[model samples]
Target: MAFSQIKVLPTTPLEKLGRVGTNDVYIQKEGSQYTFFYKNIENKEDESIRNFSFKNVENDFENFYKIIIDGFNANPIYDIKLELPNDYVWLHYTKTTSKLGVQFMTTNKVTQSTGISQIMSVEDVKKLFEKI
Candidate 1:
């Protein structure tokens, strides 16, 4: 489902942190709960933008966070960082047009869902894909 359907979800405000230069949002809460979201911008000359309605995937909060953020960090309220078991999966998707034909791309990255939501260096992430 979507974040909207999360049980006991928090209403998070979207902060304008300049031009999305590589930082993410960290949700701190009581108990053992954590939420994260990240996103990156892309430029394409020929590609259709798809909008999936929140009503359709309201149960995939984890997926929603990954779709928006390049990376995330979640932790317990204690003094240490906790690791999310293998149960949590993060996936990202992108569509592009190329000389061959239309390309549909997707990647699922495994991440520890604990510790600190470190603000990534946008430049570093960009260099990873050589977007810069």
Candidate 2:
């Protein structure tokens, strides 16, 4: 099945922020609330949307992006795991050569699922967030 085959879809009215690797950054409506998320095709049987708890999409994402990018700058070889403000979600950053691999993960008491973004250069990743 393709990524589009997933049924647990974003509610509607999606504002595509940009692309980070294979994942598409988006601000979308899920039920009554608006959310920021990374959407992609995941073979795992997890929920379709990986939502971020951003009070302000631009500012909040920028703040977190700085932290993430800064972590990479500090030591490119070290894998960084950051638990997002929304305790259930996490951003895992892995570095390879000059590129970065980012994965968005969600967890509950029983299970954990992940959405892997595309591997991209640090500059490219910065450009992706700048669009938000």
Candidate 3:
């Protein structure tokens, strides 16, 4: 699961966008198909991050694009300060729009109590993926 060894599966249409620690990011779409996957290299027990697909492809893609891309485009970064020890990764599935949204907070693996945050532009995020 080394970042350098990450590769998109054949016929899957996913494009590697880079890695955050040991988690590899990807985006995929072909015609009406749209999807995303996060491969957790650190978790040898279950390498797949899971939960990207929820049966409704169209709506899921729309929401993912809206919240992760468009929402960030509109509002920029939203930060929260919490004093917690556990790390969390959350995906919000909106019932009204039938779309997906993601939120995550990372705790220093060694420190376990301190959180790490970063700010990046939408364009920068898109640039992580190799040109097709």
Candidate 4:
């Protein structure tokens, strides 16, 4: 994508969060590099959970989500994206009796959903991630 094609979407309001009435995530584009932000569900010093870093997001999705879940045992919806077209997006992983499922969503319409990942060996995601 061209650098000029990237733009930041307006912020959305989320009441499920605390303290701040609403925090905004931005989307920006600069050529092929795209970036976005997901609210840090964990406060600093909350070692129980970890923040998304260059390592996890840059790694496999399954491993990333598992590391995230294992961090706090809390399945959090991540605000993530690359650098380039700035926009807000979320990756949500749900734990079930039989398996764990991954989903992609946006704050604008919580009711809408898309299944981007399914229960599978974390290594499988690691493979596809490499091709990306």
Q: Assess each prediction's global lDDT (C-alpha) against the native.
A: 0.29, 0.55, 0.39, 0.34
Clashing pairs in 3: none
In candidate 4, what are the lDDT values of residues 90-122, reduced to their tens digit? 455555784554333333233332222222223
Over the stretch 32-125, how does candidate 1's per-residue lDDT look in tens digits? 2332333312333422222111211444434433333333232211122112333332222222351111111222224322221222343433
What candidate 4 gets wrong by more than 4 Å, as runs, is: 1-85, 107-121
| Candidate 3 global CA lDDT score | 0.39
Query: What TM-score does each of the candidates earn?
Result: 0.19, 0.53, 0.33, 0.28
Largest TM-score belongs to which candidate? 2
Worst 10 residues of 3 by lDDT: 87-96
Best by lDDT: 2
Candidate 4 weakest lDDT stretch, 10 residues: 15-24
Instruction: Kindly report which residue stretches of model 2 are placed more than 4 angstroms away from their true locations once superposed.
Output: 1-15, 21-23, 27-34, 40-47, 57-59, 108-114
Clash list (residue pairs), candidate 2: 21-118, 22-118
Which whole-number lDDT from 0 to 100 does residue 97 have in model 2?
A: 75
The TM-score that candidate 1 achieves is: 0.19
Question: Between candidates 3 and 4, which one is better according to TM-score?
Answer: 3
RMSD in order of candidates: 16.0, 9.4, 13.5, 15.7
Candidate 2 worst ten-residue window by lDDT: 26-35
Candidate 1: where is the Cα deviation over 4 Å? 1-23, 40-119, 122-132
